[model samples]
Target: MVGEKRFRPDGRKAFREKEEFPMTETPLAARDRRATAAATARALGAALLVLLLTVAAAAAVSALTGCAAEEPTDDGDAAGVATSDADGAIVVASALCSEPYEQATSTNQIGFTVELLRLIGEKSGRGIQFTKAVNHKDAEQNITAGLPEDVAAKVAAGDAGLGASSITTADALEGVVFSDPYLHADFSVLTKMDTGYDDLASIQGDGIVVAVQGDPAIAAWVAENLPAAEVVTFDAGVDALMELSSERAQAAIVDEPRYLRYVQVKEPHLQAVETIASDKDYAFVVAAGNDELLATVNEALAALRADGSYDELCESWFGAAPERGTATRSAGEAVQDSTGA
Candidate 1:
């Protein structure tokens, strides 16, 4: 048919005339018209390819010469370039060399902080990634101290958003922000079951060695409360408690819930003497000024509890359901210094 548009066998639209032609038009004339159309299409395709190649080469030269581009960080990521997911997923960094709370370095990432990060992502409808460090304090530090420059840049870019670990809500840092506390806990003094070093008073004597986690806050707490005791700090809470097993330390100071589980399940030889009076709240943490991330994580935490997922998780980890999250209470209940949140 004359002037009938058509498509190629490959599904690309072929350049065809839609104009009407006289019935007297001959086959030779039609063939000439088709040949001309084919020639024109080929010319257009060749020009488009050249244009694309020119643009690509310009971009490559500009990148290599550092034209208006930020330098790569020590970690090899561009300082200003975002390493976050294309789908806007956030990363949660942690380094808690501890138990129940951290249990880091495991393939399963079994622990309170890691599981909480997972649930928060699920509830918030956001993708989440976990970045493990050598220890948790460094994880929190990354949110605050501006180390591993790429992460700080990522936070600003909204790619890296959280500092997950057994991060207490207390001790607000300049660059770190806290979500509502998902769990409330008290400090505790744990001792060997047969050591007769059960209470704080028993371990407060001069030369009484108390094993404590390297968390500056807990270490500071031990220093303030037990002046006469020789404080030995371990990199991890589990390691500190292990010192108690060898009589290297008479007592171990740690979060009440973690030690409770440790005593009942992992190490029956340990006893939680008693919980300290002042309570602390464990909360999800984000970089300071990350208002959007903070709000999302808080909402997810509340929903996780309201839907009973928090309870089930607690049962799995602690062997019992836990009390209501301190978020339902006053934020005032948290210690305002290195003590609590």
Candidate 2:
């Protein structure tokens, strides 16, 4: 058959007048056009993907370099820089050489607790000073002399600013308020490795000579728990450790962190076993009357927690951030300082 002629809908001839074009079942020109269109579509898709990846990478970069919402602010003074306040200055009385909490060299003051107090001062524009309390008695004396009111008197009189360097007890909570817990230390019992005492229960009937300093809480706990062992009280935990090293005491019950520090120095052949008791929560004591300062300190502590400073302090000292909890009543216990300054 002759080549079929095509016409437009407007009745104009569609085929060229030069010659009738031959037609095949599938035209190579149409196939080529389709292939070109597909290629163009793929190129466009790849270009769009590249654009998306580039935007995502830029966002990741911003997140890594403190542009994210939770990024830490780097401008705040973190080291132990003194802060000044409206008052002449807030004098912070701290025991100067306690390890894991406060420590100092000939030229530097460093530790988790000291740094925390410094941060608090920076936040409040308050000046803080570290003092050397030779012993618990010295600490108590200094606290007694510095404040116009005594803790017990303040409890009786319902005033604030009467806290001493002591542990908080349920009874004390009745009359005084404790600052945020600055430190939490576990108590452990140390014995000569050769003593064969595997745990606290094993030493119950063994006439274990436990040496401790003036910490009455530890003494009380021992008295109530290890009724069979004879607990010998000393002037300081370090003194007790010295006695144990010299073979004066068969075992020593002391703060776990402090015991770790002591063994490093004395090199005593001792083993430590810890009893999971309530953590020793150390806080600043305030007289019942000075609610203002107590609130201020508590607010400062809250700020420290929000800013990651508190967790940083915890990590520096305890190797982990402390779990936060609600406020509860803890007071009215005997005061003793095992830290020998």
Candidate 3:
């Protein structure tokens, strides 16, 4: 019955009927299925390799960019947030004075106060941003009158952190704090080499014009001590020295380091005559109530002193370390001592 032949009634031709065979795949079809599977696996492998290579490239780029961003900047501070934000920055106000201590031409603020603030920032993990004050007028005014709208007032109002310059302690700054004295300076007389006015007595005579910085205390001292001399006040030491150099004033009275640095060496036409007042102490002024910031600054100063950075700064600026046994007085105490109160 599986393979039988059947005839039609008409009898044209007989047809053979075969049994049905079970379904079996052909060799060509099997080869096609295997080739398709292999091609899919190759495509999947290529996709995974491309994904891994992309991730590796992204990681390498991130590592290189991170290293470049974390490098130290030229200002000696790590490059990061802008200091103007004040979120983690210490904003300092300083008045330009003598060279090497505070230079006008320095891009890095290569002065004593600038370097000191940088060191303090480094120790405290804060960044230093420097602002220029209107000179020592604020300190002088704070000494004479109550705190007017000056740098000290700015510090009191939280507009700035510290006032840096040759700021001394004063009795009138009731809401301000003074740091420990960094430099103990003496007030001295500067005169031309041919003036022949050696001492306060010799310089005090009729028609004698003496130039001094616009500190009321210094002006008062000159007025009280040199009664016979007329005092001319200028807002800056450079201006006062210029007055003496041009023969407009007979003598100029300024701090010792300034005289030694600006006049003695830079301006060779001038010479220091004698030391007048020897008790003035230079320090930074901060807001009174900010004890935490004050403590941080004091700690930094102590570290610098202990590590000899203070001495190095002194030598670089003053050409020698400050004398031993210098009094570390407050602004109020220094003002009282200066005024003999």
Query: Which residue pairs in model 1 clash with each other?
Result: 95-135, 95-136, 169-341, 170-340, 170-341, 175-288
Write the number of the candidate with greater lDDT, choosing between 1 and 3. 3
lDDT of 2 by residue, 252-282 (tens): 7766545555654455466665432445666
Model 3 agreement with the true structure over 1-341: per-residue lDDT tens digits: 36667778987558757647635779998999999999999999999999999999999999987654332122222322122233567776555444445644555566766787788888888887665545343545652322223556556655567766666654355456888777676665667776676444677788899899777657777877778887888766677878888888998877666655564246766765555556667677777766677788889999989998888877676555645222111111111123232
TM-score of each candidate structure, all chains considered together: 0.59, 0.50, 0.59
Instruction: For each candidate in the order shown, give its overall lDDT on alpha carbons.
Output: 0.63, 0.55, 0.65
Candidate 1's residue-wise lDDT over 1-341, tens digit each? 56656799998879856546544658899899999999999999999999999999999998886622222222223443222344555565555445777654545566776777788888878776655433134544543222223333334443445665666666444456677988777566667766777455788789898888766657667778889988888666677777887789898876666765666566767766544544477776566665666788888888988999998887777655544221110111222222233
Model 2: how far residue 279 lies from native, Å: 6.2
TM-score of candidate 1 on Cα atoms, chains taken together: 0.59
All models, RMSD in angstroms: 16.9, 19.0, 18.0
Q: List pairs with backbone clashes in candidate 3.
A: 101-112, 169-331, 170-331
Show model 2 residue runs off by greater than 4 Å.
1-88, 94-112, 130-164, 167-176, 245-247, 260-270, 287-289, 318-341
lDDT of 2: 0.55
> Cα deviation of 217 in candidate 2 (Å)?
4.0
